[model samples]
Target: MNKMAKILLVALLAVVVASCGGRKKLQENPGVSAEIGDTTSGIDPEIQAYMDANGIVDSGRYNLSDPLSNKTIYFEYDSSALDPESDMIVQFHAQHLASTGGSVVLEGHADERGTREYNLALGERRGQTVQAVMSALGASNSDVVSYGEEKPVSAELWQNRRVELLY
Candidate 1:
């Protein structure tokens, strides 16, 4: 009946109500259990299969060749702005590097549309952007390298303009 006792009683009632609300929701939606649903369930079926076959779960460590992994961060024509998906990938790898204490090489490449020197500078800039993200996420043991127009993952111009992380 005292102020302190009343406050404690109200707090206990609030906790009980909150706990009961969750229990009722769980009972109503028993099929949506977190243990039953996987994080990779929303990904591409092919990518999911590949991850399963390779024993790679949704642990944030990327499998480069997997389409869902977003390993290679592509740049728009001459822009180095990181895409949301690629930014997530960089953050994931940055966390991995921070925990593992291993060195990573950020290899930057550009399409053959520009002059060799210009492409080299562009590639360097892209690599530096990725390095900056990594540094922000506590990755210090990283190296940036520019392939410029010398290296192209494929004949496609879009594919060429990318920064790949080598761990």
Candidate 2:
């Protein structure tokens, strides 16, 4: 074979080998499943204690119509404080988490009216505030994330300022 042709063949072989190795790695680590079990049979003792303390009844299965299904809570302009309605929403989620021992991600967001850095800090503060309330209500596992003004749900500024709970 010509030298140039041999070099091209070798390069193609290397590319194929690298791609196959990546496929092998993906097959080896298939990642965790997203499916949740239907029954709450083997809950941790501490979680059970928390459920009892919070007066949460385990109905064996999660209720699709539960208040925790309401994932988003709005905030006033430049404020991280929870109003009465938001407080009630957070409380409901906290009770669900305590009962199910499930983790939650509090994603904080802000409108595009402020500096990016300031908005990011405000978003973080909002998420942390929700996390604090959840923890105080016996829900332990939570993460606070700030999206700032990067993700907007609506053109209206009031609608854009919000925190979303992700399970």
**Which candidate number maximizes lDDT?**
2
Residue runs of model 2 more than 4 Å from their true location after superposition = 1-66
Residues 1-167 of candidate 2 have per-residue lDDT tens digits of: 35674355335433432433433233234362222222223543433443454455654333322333357877889999976446545766675566568898999999999899999999999999899888976788999999999999899897778889888
Location of the lowest summed lDDT over 10 successive residues in candidate 1 = 60-69
Clash tally, candidates in order: 0, 0
CA lDDT of 119 in candidate 1?
94
Candidate 1 has an lDDT of: 0.65
Q: How well is each residue in 1-167 modelled by candidate 1, as lDDT tens digits?
A: 35674345334433432443443343335376552223334554543443454355664433433222344777879877776445545755665566557688999989999799999999989999899978865788999999898988798888899998876
Each prediction's TM-score versus the true structure: 0.60, 0.61
Model 2 TM-score is 0.61
TM-score of 1: 0.60
Score residue 83 of candidate 2 by CA lDDT. Answer: 68
**Each prediction's Cα RMSD?**
16.0, 20.5
